[model samples]
Target: MIGNNISFLKGEGYDFCELKEYEYGEDVKNIDWVISAKMQKPYVKVFHAQKELNIKIVSFLNGSTYFGTKKFKQEVITQIASMLGFICVKQGDPFASYIANETCELCTKKSKKIFNVNFMAEQLFNYDVIGKNIDYEFITNDLFKKIHHKSIIFLIGDFFDIEKLDLKLLSKKHEIFAIIVRDKFEENPSELGNVNFNDPSTNQNFEGVLNSNTIKNYVNKVKENDHKLFSHLQDNAIRFVKIYTHEDATKKLIGLLK
Candidate 1:
């Protein structure tokens, strides 16, 4: 379904980059007729091998991703990662995956093989996130230091700790793409009267009345948090997309990268 996604990074090379004077034995079909006519000589479109994109999939597997009304957020992230890995495999570009939380681990090594992609997705789907909270500062710092070359990093997470998240330095050298996976209820919650809330990251539980005021306050806080987060991303020129639990991860990703 996502076969045509990320047209810019079709996971293959030999892209039509420029036009040059046609050489002997060059295919006539590739000739740019307009340019050829203007130059009074045959000029053909030249295809240069596209640079191998170092694809890095970073999964922030915090406890919050364990919840969802239809499907778990982690599952959605896994699906997205699988699709991305497939893209890398098809294009013959090496891709790796990292799972970041209180501790970070390289879930998959740099390889164009299909096994790594499946392994990465499996690792993500089964990861235990009960008490795990993302250390964004550490993750970003490590990523900046570890990846010496420029890369296309796809960050999949809920971003509950947006205040602590900073990617300015990382974005300077690498392209950052944030895939925020969330449940709709988290964004626009309905009043449940009296309820107990759990801080998934901290494993802290609190009992409170989930009335109109609470819902209003929570929704407003979410909006404010997103505003700040989006502003920071835009200022750094980091591209991003939001995928809800009920949404198609493939379509959202295609729209973002295509």
Candidate 2:
């Protein structure tokens, strides 16, 4: 069961085993004061090597994910989530998933079962991108209450309108690995004559001629936005990976994991 596999690790090599009465040969510093106070006797912490690890994935799916030049961003999210789930199962760890789009769904699996992993992956793949906008702040705030244990978190999204403070707060509780998926067109639009651009998230329409000046400004804006997000992640010590829609998801994910 999931509860059976739960364990705690401490320090460089100390894995918490249990608490017991202080023995003659036990180190005085190892005493668990709170436990001893409750028991009216001295207790020392014990240690052993931890045997399992837990992994949690928080996926943010939005309408922007549907726009892609090659493979859809939603597909990339599924592939990456599936890969992590398989890795967790192979490591004999419990895997949990919290997917957010217009609404949120939590899949908490305690067993190391392939079925559980595949179910989560399928949910991600089939998620519809009908959300008006991704409320990343709201999602992160909800996650703060839901997640109680220390686990590796995979935060997957295009991050169109994410707040830096929310990410910082989320990272404080768990080891966060950020995956920013993007389409080629998002980074650089084709220099077509005059075109009407629609914002997928807001359903807003913008009509403009794709002249040299317009393209330059658009590219620069995209670069500036990406740089800011990257800098914030780096400053907070969050591991970040960028995946393009056109790239092979398996190869890219493997390389990033390595």
Candidate 3:
């Protein structure tokens, strides 16, 4: 099934190349109205017969991703990243990755084979998940310098912390698809009598009673944060999807791609 899906995408070069006068055999849906109005003639977008599809996976391995009810967020990240890498390789595209936690590393060279994909996945799996502050500025700066071609970047992370400015800047250069990894516990907390919560990134501890009111507040806060993040991504025209640790990662990803 996966192989069939990859094969399907291989033949469909969806990238737009340039605007040209409409041809009779061309699809009318590709017409650019804004250009047509200005030129007073029907014009359609031309795309390369064989478009270059580059895939880059940015995996955030942080301490917060280690917390999950069923499977760890880190595990989900790895699964999704590996799946994307495989898809890229199957389509004969170059696959690169940026693995970061307290520090960041970029695999700039594109890998066009299954063995290369496996190697990248191994590096992602072996990376330690120590809670470290993410330097979005530094990461984006490095990415801009390294990747010159326009590519599709899958930003996979819990995304508890991110800078809007940094995200906006990166989106301008590449097509960004955000895969938000989340745990059920983080979204909906059970009403436990007394519990201690620890910050995975900072290791700060807080003691509080999880009553009805407290639970409501927690859920609301999560929703608020989610809204802000979603809004930012949407405003920037960045496609995004949420993957929960309790769900099947492969199914979710396949559905998203479809």
Candidate 4:
């Protein structure tokens, strides 16, 4: 099945050139007559080989001390990252990650120094879960410079605001898999029932009540903001999905890839 997919991609054509010597494995029909005559040697035509669907799991674990009222987002981030990383490794795909503190590393099967899923999980888990700030613009720029090849970047965050990101820069090279993790309390702050709420990042506090209209308004705002973000992804051909902490994340992920 993988070979067939590669063949189909070749038929459709690619942007790069591939070089190969005359070999029995190659299609003899692709032989270059001019090159063979000029060189006075048997030289085969070199067609660009299509790369398989390479998947790279990119996660940003912003625990920030107040991720959720229940399970910590950092914990969830590490677990999911490990799960996906293991899956990709089993599928023979490369894995890479940038934790909240911006510790970046690449995991490859062919590496002399093995960086397996356990190593990735440990790095993600032991990473500082509190007070780690993000500079999305800088991160995006660095990603472009470093990972020049195409890939799927799964970004996990609370998405407290859009200010931290430069989506256009990332969209230029990657198909983003935006995973926004939200808890019921955050989604419906009023559900906490007449209590003080604090901005996890800044530690700013505000008091609010659980009125029907307030809940409705907050839900609509979240939905609208999510719609805008997904619209950006759609416009750029990037894949995006929103998952709630109460929901089954793995199911949603499998559905998205399928």
lDDT of 4 by residue, 1-258 (tens): 233224323432343245346777767776677777777766765434545545556666553534656676666666677777766656555666665434443433322122577787787667654545565666667767767777777777766545556678777777777777667776666554686766555556788787788889988887777677667767878766666666777887787666
Q: How do the residues 30-126 of candidate 1 rate in per-residue lDDT, one tens digit apiece?
A: 8899998999999988654456678999999988898999999999989999999998998878898999998668999999999998889889999
Per residue, candidate 3 scores C-alpha lDDT tens digits across 1-258 of 122222223223454557889978888888899999999999987654454577888888877876888988988898899899888877777778888665568743577778877777777776667666566667777777777888888989988756432577778989898899999888987888898888777788989888999989878878877888898899999888899998988888887687
Best by TM-score: 1
lDDT string for model 2 (64-118, tens) is: 8877778888888888888888888877787888888665568656667899888
Q: Rank the candidates by lDDT, best first.
A: 1, 3, 2, 4
| Model 1 poorest ten-residue lDDT run | 1-10
Give the clashing pairs for model 3.
none
TM-score of each: 0.84, 0.77, 0.77, 0.70
Cα-based lDDT for every prediction: 0.87, 0.78, 0.78, 0.63
Number of the candidate with higher TM-score, 1 or 4: 1
The model with the greatest lDDT is 1
